[model samples]
Target: MSKFFIFLFVIFIHHLSLAQSVQLTGSVISGTEKLPSASIQLKIFGNEDLFTYGFSDEEGNYKLSCEISQSDKFLLIAAYIGYQRDTLIVSRTDLLKQAIFQHNFNLKEDKKQLDEIYIKAPNAVEVNNDTTKYNVLRFTSPEDRNLESVLKKMPGMEVNKDGTIFFKGKKISKVLLEGDDLTGEGYKAITKNLKPEFVEEVQALEHYVEDNLLKGIINSDDIVLNLKIKDKGVKKIVGSIDAGLGTNQRRMLSTNLISFINRTKAFAFANHNNLSSS
Candidate 1:
C-alpha cells in the first residue's frame, strides 16, 4: 500500500510539472514609438537550433509561447530592418514563475549600416499620393540575373512557382512594363527576361477603373507593379545568338534580340528544338 501511494505521488508531481508553461508577452519600441513588424526570436543558451520566432503587430505588441519547461535560461532577440538588434538573457526565476512575463525591447537606428546601403534617402522607399516607389538597385545583389530574381529579394514581394505574384501577402492583378501592357498580364514573361540592370525603380500602386461614375463607389483591391527603365539600359540594342551542330544530324539554333530607343521598342526571339513546328 505504501509503494502504491508513493507511485501515485510521483505521477501527481510529474503532472504538476508538465502543467507549468511560460506565456511571454512584450512590446518593441524605439524612442517612445512602437516598432511594427519587429522580429522576435527565442533560443536556449549554448545550443544550435532551438529557435522560436515571431513578429510584433502593428502596435508593437507581441505574444510568444515558449516550450522551455525543460530549460530555465535562454536568450531573447529582437530585431528590425535598419535597426540595431537587442537581446535579453532570461534567468531561472522568470521561467519558474510560469506566468505571463513582460519583456520589452528597445532598438536604435543603425546609421553607419544605412550609409553603406546602395540607395540613400532620396531614392529609398517613399510614398507619394497612392503610389510607393523603391529603387531596384538597392535591393539587388551582384549575382541576380533578371527582374524575377531581384523581386524575390525585395520586401513585401513574392513570386510563386506558377508565375503568380503577390505583394504583402495579397494577390497582384497586373504587372506592367513602363505604364504599358507588354506581354499581357503574365508576370514571368517580362520578369524572367527583363535584365535587372535595365530597371531603375519599381513603382507599386493600387489600380482601379478611372470612370467618373464608378470612382469611389466601386471597391477594388487590384495592385499593379511598374518597372521604370533607365536611359542607358534601354537606349542601346542588346541580344544573344547561338548555333551548333552535333552528332546524329542534330542541329540547335536560338536567338534573342531586344531594342529600345527614343520612340521604338522591339523584342524578337527564335528557337529550334527537336520538336516539329510544321
Candidate 2:
C-alpha cells in the first residue's frame, strides 16, 4: 500500500512541474519585415501582476516562459516605435511542444492639420490657429538632470522642494502615465525618480475629471498632468552617473540605470554623499 501511495505522489509532482513550465514563442514583424528590438509583455488577463516577458532580437524573434495554471488566461502586449500596439490572447490549449505563433504589425504615423474650418450660412471660413505646443524636449535639457528639475523650467509649471507639482497657480490633482495611475505615492514618486529622458510629452488638462452631475462644472482652475511616453523610449536602456566635489570638503556620487526589453522594465539608482574622512 505504501508503494502504491508513493507512485501516485511522484506522478502528481511530475504533472505539477509540467503545468508550471510553459513556453511562448513568437516573432514580431512590421509590414512583412522583421522588427528587431521590439518589446513584448505578458500578463494574466484582468490581473495587474506581470507574467513572463521577452524581447525580439536582431532578427525579430522572441520566446518567453510563464508558470500558468489551467484557469489562468493571458494577454500579450507588443509595442514598438511608430507602430500601433498589438495584443494577443492565449489559452491553455495554445501550449504545445515548441508551438510557434507569428505576429505581423503595421505602424501608422500620427499626423494632424493645424488649420480649422467653420461653416457659415453663406460661406465657409478657414482659420489657421497658431497654437503653442509643449513637448518634453521644449522644457527639458541635459543640464536639468531629472524630471523634477525639468518641470520647474516649463512655462506655468512648478515643483516644490517637497516634490509636489503645480501649474498655472493651481496644484495638480492627478498625474497619469498612458492614462493609468502609477499605483502608490503615484506622481510624487515618478516625478522624483523617473529620468527626464523617458518623458516624451506633457499635456496639461483643465477640469480633467468629470462626473455625471459635474458636467460643465468647470474645474478649469484645477489641472492634471498627463505624461506621454515615446513608444521606443520605454524599450531601450538608459542610465546616468554623476560625481562632484564641493569647496566645503563635500563629495557626492550618484548613478541611475533603466532598461526595457519587451514588456519588462528594470531600474536601479544609488547616491552617496560624504563630508568627513577618518
Best by TM-score: 1
RMSD per model, one decimal: 10.0, 21.9
State the lDDT of candidate 2 residue by residue for 171-191, as single tens digits.
888766655555334577667
Report the Cα lDDT for residue 108, model 1. Answer: 92
For residue 18, give model 1's deviation from the true position in Å.
Answer: 24
Model 2 poorest ten-residue lDDT run:
118-127
> What is the TM-score of each predicted model, taking all chains together?
0.53, 0.39
lDDT of 1 by residue, 89-142 (tens): 886577657578888988998887776563543344544555666678876778
Error of 1 at 74 (Å): 18
With a 3 Å backbone cut-off (N, CA, C), the pairs that clash in candidate 2 are 39-262, 40-262, 40-263
The Cα local distance difference test for each model comes to 0.71, 0.61
